[model samples]
Target chain A: MPVVELEGVTKAYDGGVVGLQRASVSIGRGEFVFLVGPTGCGKSTCIRLLLKELEPSEGEVRIAGKPLSKIPRKRVPMLRRNVGTVFQDYKLLPNRTVYDNVAYSLEVIGEGRDQIRRKVPDILRLVGLSTKLHAYPDQLSGGEQQRVSIARAFVNHPPLLLADEPTGNLDPETSIGIMQLIYRINRTGTTVVVATHDKEMVDKMRRRVVELREGRIVRDQESGLYRPDESTTEFAIRLRGELGIGAEGHPN
Target chain B: MFFFKEALRGLRRSTAPALAAMLTVLITALVLGVFIPIVQATMGAASDVRDRVVVDIYVAEGASPAERESAQRAIERTANVRSVEFISKDEALARAREKNPRAFREGSELLGSNPLPASFRIVPDDPTKVGQVVDRLAPKGPEGAREPQLTAIDEVRYREEDTQQILSVTGLVTVVTGGLALLLVVASVALIANTIRLSIFARRREVEVMRLVGATNWFIRWPFMIEGVIVGFTGVALAVVLLTAAKESVLEPLSDRWAFLAAPDTIAYPLLVGLLVLAGVAVSAAGSGLTLRRFLKV
Candidate 1:
């Protein structure tokens, strides 16, 4: 069974901005799914929906076969316990050491110290950040910080992992390294969904790619590259001609 | 134990704000500690004064010796009267000399001519009874006795000004101390709420991450709420220490030197300590709960 299911999900922000438009997608356990889209095409929103960060206005989102809405408020933490989240910004608490950052997810779920003690070191080593355990977030490089963020996300060994532009701030080499790390985590039966726009990296990987255009899914294919059907000049022509009557700098 | 260690790290991370909050609470508690015991002692001493004041009534001229005895018996029987003593003219002079040796010289021009009155000194076990005794014992004389007095008593003497002044001062101390304590309590609540609010703000991103992971509302809120309580507890402990030191080193010494005000250490110390600690825990818990409610929704 799929670990996450989204059916015709739509999200509209206040003041009439649409974040997602009737989007539907499914991701199975151990599957590595890449979301590729232009800026503001709901790629991040899609990941957020799967993570239950935002509720869809028009459709249902289900995690592990249970409707997100049907999950009781008190059980939200339990639901999170089985899922791991990473962000491009590397949201490690500044005051905490790298070890504490990875251990925090366990602490937040009230996992006993013994479990945290046994699990955190191993997870840090898996992320290749064990040597930096005592280092604070500010002391680490951008790559190291992102690694810490990844380690924190994977520390609890959640069955599902959502990374929102996890490599957005890293160099291309570092980006590939992080993607490889994501692939390793996926091999462990954790479904991985990454939202990014790195064309070269996405093309070389040749994984399942779901591309978004203007808040809608334009293409979804297995072992796909980044926007294989849409040419850049065609988009430029559309930007200048078919969408010419709209405001300048607006893309369709 | 681990949370405590974490809390210590958190405090070290944000030392400036934590120290400021701690000092604010400490000063508030110190003022409370100093005033609470002093107020108690003042109140106690006032009541003691009310009970101990004695009223003396002098006998009329030429009242036979038997009438003096009757006056003494009458005063002793009065409501709230603890005891009554008769003082002869010679004894009155003797008491006067004892009170002030200079007033009664060794060799006066006339030695036996100290024409002081024979007075009945009356003391009531309860201060409230002084007025009652005065009221019940009126003039018991012939038909033509003077309007205000005097077959049995010629004059009455009581330290009305001194008693009134002491009670007024004690009442004022109680009102000021109580009012200030109430003010500090309100301020402590405000400060604690503000501290928790800032602490919540710092952890806002962590809360967002937890929500993303599908953490239950309780799971996300428990740690921050606990942090608020910890801040409150630490602030109170600091304040208590400051208070104890101030009372021992300053307020106690001042009270001891001032005869009118009993020393606070012996009298008000326990009550002060109890009130400060209680205020600390109550304000901290309430403040934490109130502030954390806003963040729990995330």
Candidate 2:
């Protein structure tokens, strides 16, 4: 079964604004997928829907083969426990140390002290931050902070990992390190979905890419580059426009 | 254990607002402590004065024995009349001389007579109903019947103004203290709520992070609630200490100086302490809980 599936999902905000209209996608287990789109193109909306943060206006969202609409409000946390999430800004608790930051996820779910002690250090070592366990977020570099966030997300070994521009704020070199860490995490049989506008990284990775334009999927292909194919379709024209190429599908 | 630690940490981080909340609770509790006893004491003094109020019926000096007997019988038959004691002319003279010997001597020498009328002191069953008993015994008639007749009674006298003053003072004391207590309570709650709101606002980002990390609403709320309870208990403890000190150093000395104005002893010290602590906890906990509802929408 697909680990993540959105069948005809639609999201409309107030005042008749379309966030995502009839958007659909699916991801098999252990697959690495990149969700590339411009701002307001429903990338964050899609991630939010998967996390059950926002309800889809008109469709089914099934994570791990269980429909989200069927999950009670009290069970959202349970769903979240099984899904790891990372953000570009590194949403680490400023008051906590790196070790505590990773351990917090387990503590919230009432994991035993022995399990937390075993897992937090192991995950931190995986993210290459085992030596910086006592450092606070403010004490770390941007790359180090993002690593803490990654460690926190992956501490539980969730089946699905979602990273929303995990390296958006980093330098190119640091971004590469962060991407490598995520790639390694995805290799451990965990389905990874990254939503980003990182063109260089998308072109370099050549993984499965799902492109969105104005709340609709414009392209879905394995080994896709950052830019669209050499076609004159309407979606290709809009994609070219978004990529800042000329109207005739050629670089300026 | 985690909640407790988090709550203590929260309290430590927001020391300024927590201290302000504690002070508000202290001031509120102090006002209640002082006024509650004062109001009780005032009422007690008023009732004491009321119990001592009696009506005095002065008879003419030349009244016969039969007339005195009739007057006594009339007083006994009056509703709410508890008891009646008759003082003869000689007994009245002797009592007057004992009370003010100089005035008695001067008056007897100047007038060459006892110059005192026999009287009956009538006590009522209920001190509050002295007016009714007095009215029953001394009935008013039309103006045509106002002439001085050959009746045994010369005049009727009681402390009308004193009783009225006590009643009015106690009534005013009750109303003013009750209002002030209510106002203080409301002010305390508002102050506490505002303080909690500021603290929560400062940590709104932290709350968002917790929500994103799948922390339940109760998990996010327990820390604030515990912080509020801590603030409340601390405030009550401080207020109780101040009240105890004030009672020992100020109230005891004042009560000693003014022997007639009794101190409040109806409520025991332990019970008062327990009540103050309970009120402090309740107000602070309720204030935090109520204010937190707005921020827990996540």
Candidate 3:
């Protein structure tokens, strides 16, 4: 089954602003997808819709073929339990130790103490933070904190992972490491959807790329580049034409 | 088990807001504790003054003994008349002599027969109702002329102006104090809720992470609610202790030094303490639970 699908979905915000417009997209189970767009182009809105954070003003969003709109508000947590997410801000529990942070996911889901004891360390090890198990989020570097957040998100081994700019705050070197980690998780048959504006990263991955512009899904390409090869050319030609340049490219 | 542990851990994690919340509760509880008894005691004194507002009804000199007895019985039956004491002419003379011994002794040689009028002293059930009692005994005529409502032999006397003044002043005190008490209770509730909101704002990140991980709203709310109760309980408990100490150390000594300062009856110390503790816990827990709704919408 397709793990995530947005069919003719439109999200209009307050004040008559449209965040997304009639966007239809689908990702099969275990497929990796990238949502790339300029800021304010509804990239975050698309991610938010899939997470059931925003109800579509039109159309439907389905995860694992179940319409998100049908899930009762009280059951949103259960829906979230099956999906993992990482954010640009690395929303770690600041007061908790690295071990507790990762283990908290399991605890919330009511895993047995013995299972928590067994699973928490293994996940921390996977995030390469075994030595810093007792360190608080504030004590970690930016990259280290992101790893802790990742470990926490993936510790439940949720079937679907949605990351909205997971590496936005990291250095390029650190960003590469985080994305590679995410890539590895995606390899394990967990469908991953990453929403980011990182050009180098998106271009390097060459994954299924969906781009938004002015709330419209202007581009969707398999093995796509961050920019559609000719998107900026029309803009350049239009600007030149306004400034009295000839069709042959000289100013007349 | 998980709920409590999480709550305790939350408290340990965010000591500043928790302590702030506790201190807010403590200060408010302490102020209320001090203010409540004072209001009650003042009210008691006012009531005492009200009880002292009395009406005196006199009988004629030629009235028969049976007539005097019937007059006394009628005064007792009058609405708002709590009790009536029959003061015979002789007894009135005796009381006058005791009150002004020098005058009585000086005038003894000139005195021929007892000149004091036999009267019944009427104590009203409520001081504010003193006018009603007087009017009941002396109903007015169609032209607003004064006439005896009952078969009173001679005269009726009371400090009408003084009673009116006392009632007005006491009524004002009640309104002001009751208003102040209501305001403080609302302030106490608001103070705790604001403190909880600030603390929650501080932990928004933690709450965000919890939501990301799929923790239910109740799961997150339980810890905060418990923490709020803990903070409130301790704060008010401490306030109660301070109140008891203050009452024992300061109020008791003052009351002893001046008997009039002591109320005949006020809210029992035990009951006041129990109510304060209940209020603190409720406000604290409610503050946390209700304020949390905004954050959980994410």
Output the number of the lDDT-best candidate. 3
Complex DockQ per candidate: 0.35, 0.41, 0.58
Model 2, B1-298: lDDT tens digits are 9889988878876688888888888887888777666666665665566567788888877788998888789888888988898988889989999999999889988999777888999888886788787766665557523222338888777888987776677667667766776786677667766766776677777777776777787887888888989998999899999999988887777876886435554466778889889988887887777776766563
How far is B141's C-alpha from truth in model 1 (Å)?
26
Clashing pairs in 1: A76-B214, A76-B215, A76-B216, A77-B215, A77-B216, A80-B213, A80-B214
Output the better candidate (1/3) by lDDT. 3
Interface RMSD of each: 2.6, 1.5, 1.1
Query: Which stretches of model 3 miss by more than 4 angstroms?
Result: A227-252, B59-78, B81-98, B101-119, B142-145
Per-residue lDDT tens digits for candidate 1, residues A1-252, read: 788888898999789989889888888878888899989999888876765557788899998888897876566667777878888898778888999887878887778989999999998888788788999999999888988888888888899898889889988657767877787899988998888997766766779999898788888899887777658875565445423332221110
Question: What TM-score, to 2 decimal places, does chain A of model 2 have?
Answer: 0.90
**How would the candidate models be sorted by lDDT, starting from the highest?**
3, 2, 1
Ranking by DockQ: 3, 2, 1
What lDDT tens digits, residue by residue, belong to model 3 across residues B204-226? 77787798789999999999999
Model 1 misplaced regions, further than 4 Å:
A107-118, A230-252, B38-180, B210-238, B256-260, B263-267
lDDT of 3 at A208: 92
Lowest-scoring 10 consecutive residues by lDDT in candidate 2 chain A? A243-252
- Tell me the lDDT of model 2 at A55: 94
| Arranged by TM-score, best first | 3, 2, 1
True contacts kept of each: 0.56, 0.38, 0.82
Winner by DockQ between candidate 3 and candidate 1: 3
